[model samples]
Target: MSQSPIVLTGDRPTGPLHLGHYVGSLRQRVTLQEQYRQFVMIADAQALTDNMGDLSKVRRNVIEVALDYLAVGLDPAKSTLFIQSQLTELAELSFYLLNLVTVARLERNPTVKEEIRLRGMERDIPAGFLTYPVSQTADITAFKAALVPVGADQAPMIEQCNELVRRFNNCVGKEILVEAQALIPDHGRLVGADGGAKMSKSLGNALALSADSAAIAAFVRSMYTDPNHLRVSDPGQVEGNVVFTYLDVFDPDKAAVEELKDHYRRGGLGDTVLKRRLTEHLEALITPIRERRAQFAQDPAEVMNILRQGTERAREAAAATMSEVKAALGLSYWN
Candidate 1:
């Protein structure tokens, strides 16, 4: 496979990956692996920015997330899958970039704002949480990445990163850092089974990527459909239906799905039937992914080795960038 041209993307190791991740980004990462210089970081350090006290969870999830990456066909040979904490250069760079960014500016960032609200920390947001965007800027510019795949909600982050890049280059008298473009996925957000706006593990609305067929089917069976569509004979609503939502994503028979929607709207179509189809569709889709995950599960050490090797390569590139950044700032004491 050819290298990923120059893409920097990763997941926070807060928990195991779910179907939402697959639809939102992992599928694209699998496709882009051979096309870009992909750097997939298991962002444990970044997770600490919010979950500071949950070190055990962070520590355990690092390998679990790596397994998910390998299981999803993120070729360690093609994509650099690294543990973010291993690269000290990123921390060093983040500190310098923090000096260039202001607290008020970070507060104004949409992603941070939304996250602060979500965490219900209006009274007491952590300092590390506030500075995460700067650390993220460091993550991208440390490698001089040209592209960062982000969801629509995360566009502000890319803007913030670029803003820092511009300010840094202007202050330092050279454009040593590269401005990254956001590659937003076509399907931005995948709603949860409970009809929640976001599919999240904490909400118990997410189906694990590694979920078993029975587990997936159960989740689908319990999925939230249109609350108003109470009976099979009643005309169902598809415009805001979560069953149809999953169908739109997982169902391959687009014509069949469309037909089902029309039948449901015209009356006589049942939620059970629609849910059964969705369950079948998800089973078909997840079966192969589950099999792949099982295969990778046998070789846990191999997965760790892949992560270690990627970390080495990632550190080398980051170190090179840091050296240049230090020289740019006339801060390199080693000459």
Candidate 2:
């Protein structure tokens, strides 16, 4: 049987991906590549919406993010991996989607509001940052992507995209755009090593995908556990402990993880032992990815070539969609 139509998902190249990205979406992306038509976008333009002044950082990190994808085993043969700014359709589609979505609607979006607060930009929010949801509609619909994988916190973004899709199709009298479904993971969020609410580079809590073994080991070693479990004999709280949480996600030995949790909760299981085990588990998980990343790093030209080929394919698809979109809106007559 033929496979379902394409699914689009991606990340801004603000930083290397972390464990939160892995558990929250990237791991799923690697697996979904086999089942669906996947287009993995490196959203450099989207990153610039927030980092407008830091063009050099955004430019540099695109390569970093692409390398991370390769290190994680995202096969270019199976997944169309490309940079976002390379396609002109996104700009055109963004214009159309903006007209469909109101400024009030963008303001009401929960994710955008939260981000404004988080970035401390109550009054000075960049226009591009405010309009990214519209741009994202462009990214998704530019390829007519049917599925958009995201975390719960990002569901509103997908809702905004679909809302624009429906409005555009209805207004133009054609189903030219596809409505994308949000695929949220079972793990709602992944906490950082410092026990922050989320794993992030800005917070100094991320264990980067490209981190060397010593760096990974240090981060894992310094990871937060149950603060109340100060003594080995003290009963520990496993519910929110970072170590146990990591164990829950990465430990293939579920029975052993359960045993460790029980022992820790009952007292006598020290944080040191649990932390060591978590470190070992993380090492096993990260070592191969790091090794693969090193090999890819040795051939930067080859990596760029993969990205270039993917960009060409993505541009073709985006161009076709833009032609239909323009024709639907009577812009084709202008040419």
Candidate 3:
């Protein structure tokens, strides 16, 4: 029988994943695991490109992200859940791949450019930060993953990875590396509670998957609706309304949600009433995930063991690929 196609995806271990993650990638991961040979990486090394000063935070969130993964139904039995920094081969591969790329090319990557601008590092971008696309190239090619699920903003990174793939294959006179394609989520991006263009943990505008009932309620109450919606009898705009945006994704009762939107637009439904319904739906959705996360958090050792085993499996695959990569570049000397 033919083997399943490999799918590589991951999260940076800087913070607990939020609803943005769920809507953008997490939900897709749960389904993809059943159909693909999936590898879910906890990207600690990449997280440290900017967070080098906060090593503890990065280390701590590795387990936190793993917990989130488990809570959301990413079965280790189906998906290889590994820590990125544990695989030394990936770093070695990245070094060789870096020679194939240039500073000008890295700067032109839209995802990298936006990240640098967001961190206010335009004047002082870290070397690692600037060249991370190469490292990402190493991560994807190491696993020979054909499918990489990512946000729309990350399309440039995948393009850069494929460029290196084609360049390295041409230099070697053969296709030594496999190119990857990005799988963007259909829901697009989930807006932040404050109505930002995106929901981000660092921005403090996200609702985490592990949030409690009180936190969920508070977040919903603070959600950005029509600013002109000052009273219960005013016609409200729903286009950019964060509450309806979330309801459209989370609330299963589509007909009810549409009716609520109609009532909201016609000038009788209060923001408080709408927010209360949203809070209830969000609470119902999150409570089970939070409980599962708590169960896993109670057994940190088992979680670490799972990561160790996954890393070992990942190391084997990476080591095999590195050997081929070395042979292609004529670096395998002691054979």
Q: Which segments of candidate 2 are over 4 A away from where they belong?
A: 1-3
Best-fitting candidate, scored by lDDT: 3
- Which residues of candidate 3, in runs, are more than 4 Å off? none
**Alpha-carbon runs more than 4 Å astray in model 1:** 1-4
Clashing pairs in 2: none
TM-scores of the candidates are: 0.95, 0.95, 0.95
lDDT of 1 by residue, 131-211 (tens): 899999999998889999999889999999999999999999998999999999988689999888889989999999899
Sliding window of 10 residues with minimal summed lDDT for model 3? 1-10
Q: All models: lDDT? A: 0.89, 0.88, 0.92
User: lDDT score of model 1?
Assistant: 0.89
The RMSD (Cα, Å) of candidate 2 is: 1.7
User: Candidate 3 local accuracy as lDDT?
Assistant: 0.92
What is the lDDT for 87 in model 2? Answer: 90
Per-residue error (Å), model 1, residue 3:
9.1
**Predictions ranked by lDDT, top down?**
3, 1, 2
Backbone steric clashes in candidate 2, count: 0
